[model samples]
Target: MKFGRRQFIGTTVGAAAALSAPAVLGQARPRVVVIGGGAGGATAARYVAKDSKGAIDVTLIEPTRRYYTCFFSNLYIGGFHEMAALGHGYGKLASDYGVNVLHDYAIGVDRGAKTVALAGGGSVPYDRLILSPGIDFKEGSVPGWDLTSQNAMPHAYKGGTQAELLKAQVEAMPEGGVFCMVAPPNPYRCPPGPYERVSMVAHVLKARNPTAKILIVDPKPKFSKQALFEEGWQDHYAGMVDRIGPDFGGDVVEVRPDSMEVVIDGTVEKVDVCNVIPAMKAGHIAALAGVTDEAGWAPVVPASMQSRMDENIHVLGDAAQQGDMPKSGFAANSQAKVCAMAVRAALTGSKVFPAKFSNTCWSLIETDDGVKVGATYKPTEEKIAKVDGFISQTGEAAGLRKRTYEESIGWYAGITADMFG
Candidate 1:
């Protein structure tokens, strides 16, 4: 409703009746410890507190006070948005929503004890736990590339400083310099993300360095919005972008950060700037909780995003494997609602609505030129099956595209408010 900004639960006769029975246990309110403060965790924390009306104790653990959203960092890279616009503080969530926002990393999750161990040497006990730890790269996914080499070849995939570093690298490149991207494999966060990053790079290069070249070495044969992105590249930044897929040995690639070289199918190319998006897995906290499977993603029940390993633990965002629903900010935010509803019902005996989820991923190709793919979903016996979907048509009008871009901007504002307030 109105793009997730609608107040989930407010004062009403039904809600008042629901709160008649307090959910407190052992002289304390029901504790909901959220191990992240991004789209999923932030929204969950806000909703659990807001809807429960102090019946639930919501504590959010996030290492950063100001979160830089990966969703719009590409626009920042393209100069369409400022870094300041991408930063969101937890003040509103703390002051307005009555959420205990802790700026700390959650190092461990003790399932048996139902406590989260913080790096600061204290443990937070929770009756219910929500884990939205986004994504972490797979070790050795990109040979010779690790945290140490991140400064040289920034992934920029996580948003924040990495994105700023990549922007600076692109801006500092010489005229006609080469920019290479080693795209991640399938099922990573944001399927269309790498292409969107390429578009952002092209947008910068087109204005600042017209002769600059952008190269993409992608492991996937086809990417999200392939034809639309390819068409936009041809029409907006022709001859400036080139994509090498697995059919062309794109999968067989390695990066030598020391030499600033990318080996594509054994052919070495010295690039002026490199962006390596490695294969991703669930965030470290999920694995620490012992909820992740061999594939490094936590499985959840379709109706509720509760972890299969522990019913008390719910996993959202990129860390969850709920099936079909792409790992995206919108998806996470949507899933958080379902999980919040379920958690409240289980704890406070509130009415539990059937889970229905939706997601829309918007990508900007150039200034005021945007495209989107979205779907409505419902839970099935096997997975979260897609009900239907829509995408930007190939021959859409420019006016429509501009409207879509504006809609996305509005969505950014609405969703952030929904999460924080």
Candidate 2:
């Protein structure tokens, strides 16, 4: 309806203003990227995607298409369970929870720009970043222990490749061969894992080759569920499993993988099969980002799970510095939920709440018997504190151990469902 030049100019201005209104007023949903879809990252992605609905976008970056949990891998070594059972798929996170799962490793983190650099030549931008890349073996911590040497002396604690190597070694040993395992120092992932692995391997040896022996050279004076483990060893596989704690002159200072020997107190002991669980640190990505301390663990606020160095990023799982909590799969999953809630609050300007976490670790002593330790925790001002905990009592009846074994399988099913389903 413009008739003159001034009227025409006025009409054009009004139409342009109307066209730009929605673009200015309607905001886009915030994006969250999680690196390492193992225990912590998978749960965090699932929770954030489900809880946020359409208000948040979640992407999970992991190098593996499927996850092989270290939780029950000892059973696989013992032939009590198949490797298939320990492996999990991410279909639920992608289909049901609407999470974008990327099978790629994160190489770097650009905190200022909030972008995660991928190893496969791409960068993903995010409003919030959560990293749970798990533990990395500290190079040079043990002489003759490096990525190449790991192929010979496998540390099956990390699952995947190491698990396979150890399993193959166990299968190939002679009837009277000796298997040696050097347990890592304190503050490693899965405190009971190495011991459980030794127990399970001994169980296999007892059945396949009764004359075989397993020697555990532990750096610590004791380990998680030490009494229970020793009891199980004595009751089930006596003369097969021999453990040497620090008190018994059992500390490994160096490894000679080529010679199939480990040097402890300047003495070299040759073995048919060797597994060296060296000292662990945070994943390389976290260390490269400067989020980890000299101890190689990332520090975070107990209540918020927010990085002490970077507020926009949160660290969880084994990579995080969570004391008083054993680095178990259940612990990582619990930490993930807490981190999801914290991220939700940060994005929406809602109140950040205190965190409560729980951990339960189950290990198979034999084919039908299992042992477990669990705890419930609450965050204090500075750290996460354990509130209540329990371990499988010594001298427990066979029926009780059997029931615990069944219960452990059920727990595994339930946990994976809760994490990915």
- Candidate with best lDDT: 1
Itemize residue pairs with steric clashes in candidate 2.
none
Instruction: List the candidates' TM-scores in order.
Output: 0.95, 0.92
lDDT of 1 by residue, 1-421 (tens): 2232233222111211233246556767789999988899998898888888888889999999899899999999999999998989999888888999999999998899999999988999999999999999998998889989999999998969999999999999999999999999988999888999999999999999999999999898999999999999999999999999999999999999999999999999999999999999999999999999999999999898999999999999999999999999989988888888888888887877668888889999988889999898899877899999999988789998888888788788878877776
Q: Which sections of candidate 2 miss by over 4 Å?
A: 1-25, 350-353
Q: Cα deviation in Å at residue 96, candidate 2?
A: 1.6
lDDT of 2 by residue, 13-94 (tens): 2211111011112688788999988888888898777766646789999999889987778888888778887888999899
Worst 10 residues of 1 by lDDT: 8-17
At residue 234, give the lDDT of candidate 1. 96
Cα lDDT, model 1, residue 242:
93
